[model samples]
Target: MTTRPLPEAAFRVLLSLIFLVSGATHLLRPEAVAARLDGAPFAHVATALAPSTSLVLLAGVALLAGGLALLVGYRTRAAALGLIAVLVPITLTVQLAPEALGPLFKNVAILGGLVFFAAHGSEGYSADRALRLRRARRLVPALS
Candidate 1:
């Protein structure tokens, strides 16, 4: 027998964990992240945002909010789009170097997945579905 694939919800959860951990890491260790970016070409952009720590922490909070929303299937499309917005600049600015090919590829792959999710939405087992179902149920009685 062929092996069964994981459920869509499980896949979503697994995928979302990446962002969750990344966000938490940024929030908990902004200094570490800042240190990594300290000498990067675009470090000035981050510095312009005020202290590097503040900017990094803010990015982390945004990631956390988007990741949490995606995880719960609440406005998943929007959440995915938000992640895409955040990832594009990062991939462009941080991962475009010769030695950064791996990170660049990874970000591109994640971006592709987010684009698909944004287009198709959270297929089922989500707050969006639950709300839709509830609304449909309410409408049915009036139609009847």
Candidate 2:
């Protein structure tokens, strides 16, 4: 049997969920994540912060905000772009290791998805669509 294609909204939600969980984990377990990045370039940036965890928390917050925006289809392209920014450095610094091939490839795939989302607006069931609908309604007078 042929498989049906997933709806755009459903796909967006699924993708956003990945970031949501990852962001929450980063915020909740900063030390563990920091440990993973111990020798990475990002660790230097984190060290520059007054508290070592501050930079990690900041990154988490950015990820959370971007995920939320993507979930609701609000400024989706911007959200996707933000994710790509975070993912690029992470993939290079954290995931690119001889024993980490799986993770590195996964990150690359995720980056591809984010790029696609950034290039194409959320298709349906999104705040952007709602806003557009509202504007259209205002522009077209009600039939009396």
Candidate 3:
């Protein structure tokens, strides 16, 4: 059988993997994550919001869940949008420092990726497709 190509889905899955791994690392070692976040430019907002451990756990869980949703192509656009929303606060809070330019660039790149995915559904290899198809079928009878 010929395999259908899914470049968009693949790109999304790869980006999701990156988020998942980062989240897992933070969840597994809150202190380490805390230290890193503390040193970053956006530490002030994080510090103001919650304990370092709690922030790490919350961010980690969000990333993991969002990543999984993207990976499975389930509501992928919504998931991508959610991930972007979550990152915005962190990005603004932490990556504002001049010294944090490198990380800031990376975050910007990820943001762009999230936006791209948000606009384009995961094509054929996604739950969105099934849902869309169902909706289309439902409307067919009325139109006919």
Q: How does model 1 fare in lDDT?
A: 0.80
lDDT tens digits by residue: candidate 2, 1-144: 222224778878888998898899889999987777776655555465545566668778988999999898898899999999887877876776788899889888888778878988775788877888898898788643
Task: Name the best candidate (by lDDT).
Answer: 3
Instruction: Give lDDT per model, in order.
Output: 0.80, 0.80, 0.83
Give the per-residue lDDT digits (tens) of candidate 3, residues 31-119: 99888778876677678888877888999999889999988888988999989977887788778888879988999999999997788
Residue 94 in model 2: shift from native, Å?
A: 0.5
Expressed as tens digits, the lDDT of each residue in 32-71 for candidate 1 is 9878666666777757767777767877988899889888
Error of 2 at 27 (Å): 0.8
Q: Locate the minimum summed-lDDT window of 10 residues in model 2.
A: 1-10
Highest TM-score scorer: 1
The alpha-carbon lDDT assigned to residue 125 of candidate 2 equals: 86
Which clashing pairs does model 1 show?
none
Task: Tell me which of candidates 1 and 3 scores higher on lDDT.
Answer: 3
Using lDDT as the measure, name the better of candidate 2 and candidate 3: 3
